[model samples]
Target: MQAECPRQPPFNCSCTLDNVVWDTSRLYLIPIITVDCSGLGLTELPGVLPSNTTSLLVKENQISDLRPLVNNEHYRHVADIFLDDNLVESVAVLEGSPWLFNFRVFSLRGNRLSQLPTYALDNALERNRHVVDIFLGNNPWQCDCLFTPSFQVNTEEG
Candidate 1:
């Protein structure tokens, strides 16, 4: 017999964790699964995620490190990720991960990121510049010599 995915009717939560109900109805369509667990006060990413998750919305939480998400085979299909209003200090989680390849929209607004590794953004740009939309605002950005070249180029281009 095939294992059945349990359904909770009262709250309409498809997946329950730590008494927090995850509304799985936000899933737009088959190829575009959107799991929105926003404003749940979550400290970390959920261990068991839907294997077909394409857009993950986990904003307004206390998630600090994203390293745990790197090895999760379930996250391989993620394209759009919204991690705003969290405690993310660094994106070392995506430093060398293959997820950077298909990563389309990454919004880190209102986080603790100081600087992003240009190589990672460069890789995403190399893949598809027009499809990538990275939002990095409302953080204490470090504008040092490391940013001189790119800053000058972008300033000139702008």
Candidate 2:
């Protein structure tokens, strides 16, 4: 089953769903195109997501792998992704999402990551990467030989 987002009034912002609980089916009909699915207690992302989505917010959930969102064509255009509080252990998950070429802002405040996963910043992704801020506070900051020893995390208010 497929539903098209109409381009007219009176029915411009309309959506369809199939028995999704826990605020999962709420962002469908809104014509905003950008949806933030953060802080909703979502263990994982819904299998069926809007193809035209430009921004996705899946912060403060139980998500450990953001690789699921990399498959869609719209994932590249996503300007901002908030993963401030979750069980994420590595930004290596970005490896799965190539469309994440030039993210304007990113947040991974609370997670299990001991240090920034410099291993994840390999080729292709390191070329056009331009993130203004990447919040890595509240995680296990271990200054060891495993991660980037020179990687200094900044947490200034913006």
Candidate 3:
């Protein structure tokens, strides 16, 4: 069974429904939703997302702020977030957010990041104790005193 994607206003994107489950008594399709909003030249993220969305792809946009992902309740269940080739400069907002500790896949390739909040990320990784894939390639990373040691530690630990 397949269900049509819900019409979310203010954003145009493609949706794929996977992992379909059919319940005989309920007569409904339970789908794992993946929302693809890549290469839309968007300045911000979509205000609304479909229920049960687990993967969100918003790469190649102009999104710089991650407050929405941290502050908004709509993204509580999202596990995989691809933000490659965006304008994200800092991930400080993810300091204490659950997304830092619970995300399965978080990609930030080809962004403008030079440094990272090592303390928060280290704490989150320690707490997670789960296998997570984090992509940070293609960014202009500055290998300075503050970043080198922490990066080495995180890499060794992770």
Best-performing candidate as measured by lDDT: 3
Q: Which regions of candidate 3 fall more than 4 Å away from where they truly are?
A: 1-10, 21-29
Q: How far out, in Å, is residue 73 in model 1?
A: 0.9
The digit string of per-residue lDDT tens for model 1 on 1-158 reads: 01111122221213322222345798443433566667777787765555466667888888887865578776777678889999998885676677776677878899998877776666656676435577778867788998656634532422
Predicted structure 2: lDDT: 0.58
Say which prediction, candidate 1 or candidate 2, comes out ahead on TM-score: 1
Decreasing lDDT order of the candidates: 3, 1, 2
List model 2 lDDT by residue over 13-46, tens digit each: 3333423324356744433354556566666654
Lowest-scoring 10 consecutive residues by lDDT in candidate 1?
A: 1-10
Q: Whole-model Cα lDDT per candidate?
A: 0.66, 0.58, 0.82
- TM-scores for candidates 1 onward, in order: 0.72, 0.63, 0.86
lDDT of 2 at 134: 59
Identify the leading candidate in terms of TM-score: 3
> For model 1, which pairs clash?
none
Local distance difference test, candidate 1: 0.66
